[model samples]
Target: MAKFPLSDLRFYAVDTNVLIHDPNALFKFEEHRVVIPMVVLEELDKLKVGTTALAADARQAVRTLDSLLGAATPAEIMSGVAIIRAGGQALGTISILMPAQQSNLGLQPNSNDNLIINDLLVLKQSTEVADVVLVTKDINMRLKARGAGLSSEDYHNDQLISDMDSLATGYHHVVGSFWEQIEAIEPQRVSGDGYHQMNSATLQAILERKLYVNQFVYDDKEFVCRIYKEVGGLVTIELLNTALLMRQKAWGLAPRDLFQGMAMWLLFDPEIDLVALNGPAGSGKTILALACALEQTMESKDYRRIIATRSTRGLDEEIGFLPGTEAEKMQPWLGAFTDNLEALHAEDFDPGSSADYIGAKVPLQFKSLNFIRGRSFQQAFLIVDEAQNLTPHQIKTIVTRAGEGTKVVCLGNLAQIDTPYLSATSSGLTYMSERFKGFQHGGSISLQGVARSRLAAFAEAHL
Candidate 1:
């Protein structure tokens, strides 16, 4: 699994952003040396003060570091301390790179990043160097490190895919009849639903990648089937009527495209607990998700309420300064939901009043991501918007807050991520989709095309 090991182990000096991005990254480097600079510790100490997600991560990183260094003396810490795993197996050595005094590598004073680079430069020339490498999430820092004549790389342990185009789209689109590729199948009817059981190896070329329970296979011959069960090299496919799926509706909203139609089926079904919807702007991601939430909550009573939150920069810092309740403060960030609700009820006799009535009567709540931390929601539809902006660690923290009977819908356009130090391939949304690809109760659909307007669709394809 390792790229290279044994004699090729290099010293990986992690940056503050890397630690904040993932607290447990210290132990991820197996059998290699991990170095933490003194300036990094000072930065962590200064940041670990607030209840914000960033502060929480800082505190966790500090705690993890403190726990790892347990009772090591200053001299031993400077030399190296054995980094032990959870099972008490010593895998690698971790040490603090002391401040460099006589090194000529120091840049302009007062910047922790420059100071860390200075210390790393000195360490690179020391006897302990197998090959010095700086691991950082900051692109500019990586450039600076390389400019200062040092090895550097981005944190890739959590980046599952190397290319964004290789990401799963949750469905296989076949132009011809799907049965043309299948050699044989055991067909059955379960309580009026058509089911087919076939050897997975027979459909290897059609499937391409490994088959998952929630993935779909559709053909232009008016055939659509989902992999509902897989056991002992055989897959049980639940056949879905293409016409029926295209007619699926939620909260008086009909899908504009086949992708939206498929997404609505998955989001409306209580059997699936997590649905990841990603596409370009105006691909009906929010509208479809909101419609499904309202349908399940207000109409079917499947959920008690809808809890909405999104990843926006400076939300944690600016939300506390706003002059209202948490819901009121979050209203600005969650305008997409209200905006889509208005669209959903635009055909009503009084759209404004209808939207207001639902807002007043329905239990729709806007929550801050900061407040969502550590809180559990039961029988709730939790929509996490702009998930592409979240780190793998932050998304995991929020998703784990789901209590029994709660369904979490993560929506984002990977190409539209705004968060610094994140890429389409490295985004939390992509990470979650990849990690949950095989989950029996989770499904992801990368909605295709811009379904907003002719102008928007033209711009999406051309501009």
Candidate 2:
């Protein structure tokens, strides 16, 4: 762990989500005098009234404040901790600045983000007597804070994996005589620490050779064994015959959507028991996974059912009382699922049957990270979407749910978006990629291209 220069700091202005990520943040900064910039408290208050994960976090922050202030006014500065009601006047180590009287300064209209920025500015001006650091997880906000001459930093609550190469160490790259030698051995079942690391060409070769279990092959002089093991087992997707051809046609594509093809190959591979997909927005992570599920369920009948799930990290505020059964409550968060289904159905799939299977073919299940406890899945093609929002702990919860004959596909964009405490490198998707890199059944591919639209790709790059 890196040591922070905490001894010299007198005031630390904490961002709302930082506290929400870990409620014990108050005690984490124990010895140092901390300031909950009034604006942050107001933001927490607004969050507390909602039903989303943020609301739950906000309520926790309020409870912590109540413990400190003992029913005092919301803006009261008690003890060394000052709870400034955002926009209220208070003497503290930081001042909350309102938006400068200008509309063209890139401030979004009626955005609370603007208020947070203004508050940070005020706190920066007021803290002239001490060193002040504005902490936030937002990249744009960090950029803006730097532009104003304020010392700023990412919250560091969630970070990406440090070693990128570690995500591919499990699969052996075969060439020359070794490749031919393995082809000759023709193992019936092949297992490695990370099987997903193998390219589609290698997988296809294994499938064509009809190799059985206990077969051994050599990569050069290094001997590799064919041990049958299941990690995240094969994901059977039912897709249109065209979709299957599209993937088979894209064999060995090395660019943005390569992961899509890779995932498709894994779904078709009988040897691979587990596969993981990690990428950013417009990377075709979800689309490919959905297509694979469709193909397997409708065509091969390889798996009993396709199970799709996403962590409801940021569903909405006041979601607990949304007035509906489980399916109805899930409508809003499952919009992405619906959109992906609609696109797949457009490829000449029967819409009537597709609707019937929307909740049945690839049953989209809305499960929070907290609800994954005490569950086991078997013989299922499982797809975990939006995996970037999950923490390492949360990822373990979902992955461990895999029972016999279950292949889990974790899909998410490392960049473009994340949850409050997660980032591109530190998210569960990256964690799994790195941790399971050496496993024979586990595979990971980073998606880079935007297939949604030309304008979407342009916006992702330029805007």
Candidate 3:
């Protein structure tokens, strides 16, 4: 149904944010024609002046445009150039829409949105593309385009899942009995490593095709199993020690529920390279990640340091202008980690001092995403909070920086995404989680319930 929104449009005029969100968006339309307004190029040029991630994206978009349109003459440019991928597959055609004569959109040119709407209006008048669509990430821009008698749509090509509820919660929760499908078990490995071989083709029918590797399956009767391997019709499930999982501790923290337990299992597992935690506002995502990070870095000595970061609107443009050292500027955005640190040490006589001491003791560094490009980290525990605000490209840029022996944990509340361009289904957290669902070294869990406070939980439910 998500794919139903985007009918293969013959002609599409893309907005600047769409290109920024995915720099290679021009070539993704698959044999269709893509139109880039001259004003959009000008907007990208202005955004290219900063060192932020936005600036990087703008520069990349401009570079892609140049690479495609550089050798073309005015006549050929007026027509269109074939869009080719880096893998040498030719798909669509891209052309620039120049400034048109006075348009009848009746909107002032005080904003870029108005200019694009006016340009599209003029283009529709001159050309037979009366159904030409404006692809954008702005809701108000789409509304304005409609008011101007132009068709507009959201950039939904990268939205993998149509519905948010269909997205996996990193586990399969069954009602009555799920073990009835199991026919045989290997007693040797079952006693030694908790491994059990079963026919998952039968289980897939039972669960309706939600099963994947590294996903936990549990029933109401206290049965818990984690799928580590899936070979054709046969599936390998490692029965989990529920008592040990419930009693799992990182630093001084414990899982509030089985879902949180599954999340922490992925966090502490030496095999999992990426762990994603999705939940509501107070579901202990940050606290759990912080606890595991501390346990691994401080006690286990598995990692060298901890890098904390997040993505928020206006953070890229304004972080550099803030007064203070890099750490001081990042402290405001990273206050959640420190706040959770206080939570971890709340039972101490002096929780404030304990948090401070732990902060000083652990090699925890709060860094901004602005300067994270092109840098690599080895033996590091990278925690990316507010991951739902990230675009698919932006998250890829961050996750690719992990060197060998590094683990990344992404935490986000899809219910509270503050970015204008992202929704629960289109978030980078959702994108990465969907893309990495079957990765052997990756796991994700949706932490249920609100663990903040009675008032917070009440507000989460009623508000």
Candidate 4:
């Protein structure tokens, strides 16, 4: 809660983009009045005619408005509609900019955005509403509102953090005599597996922040490390054994860095159902995910088949439409999948014969994000590649589709998001990683160091 006085409330005139971006933006402003221009509603009506995410948001926002105005009379609605929440608790009032009340207000109604701003300009003079600010997701609308001498702000309730660095890396850097501190504590042996038990309070005090089960803790001084696991106020720490990783390979792909090694461990852990892999381009985000999926599905027979999907939108041009079946249409978008497959084949299989290489191709099913709704994946390894382009709602939809024995692996480079209106902080990849950081059954890793080539790494560092 802000420290400002509650009585000094302000009125926010919302734009169409804000409501479309987040349907519940109406109730986000606590104890502050929300004003809606008729032009915004007109824009929503036009946007509500499609099957896209924006269309769904538009319809939902309209439905929310209808419910708010359900018990109000026409006169009451014109003046102000009481905005009641789920518990019938009224936070504030919502008023629509009526046609009869539309004043010229020294601005032309040529554009709907301009008209919305003009609505606030007129309300500031005609009503006693303090601070008629225009809240929007559109940068141009916010600028125009401010240019007209009106207060403006971006809707920020959905934003979790402004900077990506604020997110947990799932790896804590322990410093200075960490082994001596552990040696001082007489830990009781948990099992034959080299796990030492410690007091939960002591562990919490030493770590400061709450450590998620399975989160890695490491010290650069001699690479002293442990994995965290807790049960009922009792915490267990196991010496991280990189020897097992050194002896193993997933579909002919080995971990290139410490972060990649941690990501691979999480991917191979059967106890974890969801794993998020984040990195820049050429960091093996896709390759690692694919290798883990193949190892689980084909080699280990842990799952039935692998289902791969990605946003059709690309960096340069979208794979707008293609002929043939879904697999054929998605082939262009699956270049990463094939590229990694070819690389793995060249590295793992006999180089003399193309037959072995062709046979080594894992059984894969291509899925489109648009058709993923109302479907459940059971006993399958579902890989969502290029997930940074996905919205938080889209990520939720995909994650919820997992059925029994289904593991979800989300892979993406946050710096390579092609979707408009998304940033590093707001990308679904970042949101998923941040939200599921400490969950017992979920894990996230941000891969560092490029593993592609010297040339690629140089280009990434400079360009």
1-463 in candidate 3: lDDT tens per residue? 0011233446789999999999988877787779999999999989998789999999999999999999989877887788878899877788899876654454788788888888877766656432578999999999998987889999888889999888988888767766653432221224566788767766676677757899998887778889888887788888885676899999989898888889989999999999999999999999999999999999999999999998878776668777999999998888899888888899999987897799779899999899999999999999999999999999999999999999999999998889888899889999999999899999999999999899999999999
What's each prediction's TM-score?
0.95, 0.53, 0.94, 0.88
- RMSD each, Å: 3.5, 11.2, 4.2, 4.3
Error of 4 at 322 (Å): 2.6
| Model 2: residues with Cα > 4 Å off, grouped in runs | 1-10, 21-34, 60-130, 139-149, 161-274, 279-284, 291-305, 310-381, 389-407, 418-423, 426-428, 431-443, 447-463
Model 4, 50-125: lDDT tens digits are: 5555567688889988888878888787666768887879888887876435565646778777777776777676
The number of residue pairs in model 3 that clash at the backbone is 0
Ten residues in a row with the worst lDDT in model 3? Answer: 1-10
lDDT, model 1: 0.87
The sequence of per-residue lDDT tens digits that candidate 1 reaches over residues 123-193 is 77663427889999999999999998999999999999999878999988876878865644433234554
lDDT of 4 at 232: 83
Task: Quantify all predictions' global Cα lDDT against the true fold.
Answer: 0.87, 0.57, 0.86, 0.76
lDDT of 2 at 194: 35
- For model 1, the stretches where C-alpha displacement exceeds 4 angstroms are 1-8, 183-192
Q: What's the C-alpha lDDT at position 89 in model 4?
A: 92
Could you tell me how far off, in angstroms, the CA of residue 271 lies in candidate 4 after the best superposition?
1.3
Question: What is the TM-score (0 to 1) of candidate 2?
Answer: 0.53
